[model samples]
Target: MLMRTGVALAGFYFVAQGDWTRLLACFLAARAAVTRLTRPDEEKPHRLAEEVGREP
Candidate 1:
């Protein structure tokens, strides 16, 4: 969860900075989103809402 948050935050920061070197924003965003979407409900170790907290 912490990893996900950090990735998303950093991605947004890079996007706002308009730095192509950090175009990793696109990659991070896609990865986080794909993981969230593909994770099985029962496979999750914790409650969905609790683990992910809030979304941007």
Candidate 2:
């Protein structure tokens, strides 16, 4: 999430500087980041805590 945020912020810089090529590159990179960000986490840390909490 942080990485994607940083990449998006960088894109704004590229746009401000009129770097079209890099801006396009950032767009592609952001797409890839979004793919990962949207994917379900295979190693969710909360699962363990939830399982423990459920043990009344």
Candidate 3:
């Protein structure tokens, strides 16, 4: 959560400096980090099973 907030703040800084490309990249990275953090832990077992070629 802290990392996501930092990334968002960096994005804002880029925006203030008119650095559109870096801002967009930072925003995308922050979104991906948040999405990863919020995902249900229940999915992990299924993912691990798939990785090991086993049924979940």
Candidate 4:
């Protein structure tokens, strides 16, 4: 949620400052980074439950 909020804030800031090229580049970079970072770890709801010491 925090990561998403930061991305949203960055987008609005870029738009307000009229930096179209920078906005596009930043968005692409973020997309690539998120894809790479999350690719190794597939989410499973059951795993999350266990992590928090709960049963699924």
Candidate number with greatest TM-score: 3
Per-residue lDDT over 1-56 for candidate 4, one digit per residue giving the tens place of the 0 to 100 score: 99999989777566657677777777688788887767744453467677899866
Count of backbone clashes for each model?
Answer: 0, 0, 0, 0
TM-score list, all predictions = 0.39, 0.42, 0.55, 0.45
lDDT accuracy of residue 41 in candidate 2 = 69
> Compared with the true structure, what per-residue lDDT tens digits does model 2 show for residues 1-56?
99998976876676747677776776788788878778786644466678788622
Q: Please provide, for model 3 over 1-56, each residue's C-alpha lDDT reduced to its tens digit, 9 standing for 90 to 100.
A: 99997976865776657677876776788689888888898754577787999977
Worst 10 residues of 3 by lDDT: 10-19
Query: 24, model 2: CA deviation in Å?
Result: 0.2
Measured by lDDT, the strongest candidate is: 3
Q: 1-56, model 1: which lDDT tens digit per residue?
A: 99999987786677758766566666677789999889997766566567689532
Query: What pairs collide in candidate 4?
Result: none
Model 4 per-residue lDDT at 35: 79
TM-score between model 2 and native: 0.42
The TM-score ranking, best first, is 3, 4, 2, 1
Evaluate all candidate structures by whole-model CA lDDT and list the values in order. 0.73, 0.72, 0.76, 0.72
